[model samples]
Target: MANPDECDTMIVGLGAMGSAALHHLASRGVKVLGVDRFVTPHIHGSTHGRTRIIREAYYEHPCYVPIVQRAYELWAALEKEIGERLFVQTGGLMIGPPEGELFAGALRSATEHGLAHTILEPAEVQARFPGFRVPRGSLALHEPRAGLLLPERCVEAHLALARRAGATIRTGITVTGWTADDGVRIATDAGELRARTLILAAGPWLPALVPDLDLPLNVERQLFHWFEPASHPEWYDAAHSPISLIEYADARFFATFPDVGHGVKAGIHHEGAVIDIDAPRAPASAAEGVEMQALLARYLPQAAGRIVDRATCVYTNTPDHDFLLDRHPAHPNVIIASPCSGHGFKFASAIGEILADLATTGETSFDLGPFAISRFQAPAT
Candidate 1:
């Protein structure tokens, strides 16, 4: 039996990645404990958004294709395990000029992986979905197996299953600091505990927790808005419309989701203010809403309606915008997972399994070369 004060593995931050990790580790019969400062599925962090996009033909890199594919399978299995619908299959569209990064990257991944997709010109896009006004020079890459994940429910399900599997969970407690000797010792606001392994999955709070590493993690404030359709409401439904990432301007992109209860959701990607996580976030400005409405007026004109709701979230981005998943350089028993670069929620299910594999075996089959911490380290003189 595991001691109440200690466990085989301790996961910090019960958001998307941490909750999933706890579930996977517990399901494997490993004695694990998950601690979070706030009750999970809360709006305080990055995981509270109602809808998150999940796509297979990844534009980031071909290497992520397999990982996301596995995530899709695991997501389906999770739905089966919980007997609830978590994923909504609305398909997905990558729209931009043929030579632009958005469209080209999606096409490359599709071709390399032989994923089923279609290339639709602007005229075809408008004809198929009258709600859209695809730019004159833009094309869209449509893939069948892309959609949105119910983020809050996903986190809730993971934590529920983890508890059912005998994993210990503590919320409303903060980890102040940690030290490693014979094993890992975590100091929290309530008390201290020890674990053989520690996984730091705290999204934006990661850099502060591991000050020795001096990680180059940037926390950016992002906003997502839900607007009631101004016209052709049926055309914006999941059956007629797919979640889309559109490169409206050169090297600038925004994502749009079909109405799933609240309203048609959309957000500009990665253009938010870089903020200090500890500081109070500035409220979304009227100018920001006007900018978004203007974009919609040009592209998704039908979705340009009165704002039903809006929320702020943060993305802990790395310099390269890729993920950072690896063990601590000096402490092999310690693993660091800062996967949220605005595109990581979908992979949380699979990343949890990888974190479990690393915790138990110290290695994973997934090639984590691109995510290695050494990539950011200075070369030896």
Candidate 2:
């Protein structure tokens, strides 16, 4: 009959989104408690890799432009506040056919938002960026604001700032279950705790937390590889090379980043195996490596070199490949924020502020119509 530990708000999962929320909430002087099953900047979740692409002209939809714009401002402010380098501007190119999803979507957003961009022909792309061998009919949409964000460092900065702002963060603690009546009562392996509001940002383990929702969430196993340049090493340098996304064939796409200390980093988007969160994650196999090398040989020939390192990460994807940022349909006090698909790291900064706004004021200024959980709700007869 012990009284449960209490707080104004409790956040589960301390990855990119969770850490940002902690920083924002704690800065507002809210008594917030954040718990993570692993260390804050661990490599198990979706936000580990050294670099994540941050682009202004979102190819997915035009609605993302404003939020990402906000993210840029916040990222710069965070770097200044923490005195840490988190973002690098290498520009970016979306290469594909004029009508392809990558190119057309990026163009649509750029045109809609009046973003600074240019459409480059095949010869232009090849001449300006020697590392790429774009096909004759393909084109490239060059956006100056697109670049790389250092995810691990960003998470570390957020956690550090949150701690300094008086937020209590507990690592290595697993949340078993939670109940919501007047408030939220979370049961963990250590003990039980109570909170006036609960924010569930559990990335891949989100489904396990709310099994009753039966969300159509898929966890995919992804691979990231860094390779030494075999030739024209200068073409792969950060200054010389721009973060590029190639729609090599139809919907199949792969993205690359210039060498930032590590070898040139590359990965195929959404071309990963669906997996369970608890299952043992397998490393990039020989076949996978060969596939990636072949890709490089075809498009980025000079980057086809010795594979220096490989890593595995998971992407918790939603059906529409959009974000899931909404409240639990059954519990108003419980908010669900995960299922970022594969392209969510870039928006974690703004999303953290959005989540904080939602948790504190029950609403946010950003248009979250596309990310609502009710979209998955069945229609009534």
User: CA lDDT of each candidate?
Assistant: 0.92, 0.92
Among the numbered candidates, top TM-score falls to 1
Q: How many residue pairs clash in all the candidates, one count each?
A: 0, 0
TM-score of 2: 0.98
Give lDDT: candidate 1, residue 354: 97
Off by over 4 Å in 1: none
Per-prediction TM-score = 0.98, 0.98
Lowest lDDT 10-residue stretch of candidate 2: 1-10
Clashing pairs in 2: none
lDDT of 2 by residue, 1-381 (tens): 122267888999999999999999999988899999999798888988799999988999999999999999999999999998999999999999999999999999999999999899988988999998888899999999999999999999999999999889989899989999989999999999899999999999999999889999999999999999999889998888999999999988999999998899999999899999898898899999989988978888999899999899999999999899998988988999983899999999899999899889999999999998889889778
**What's model 2's overall lDDT?**
0.92
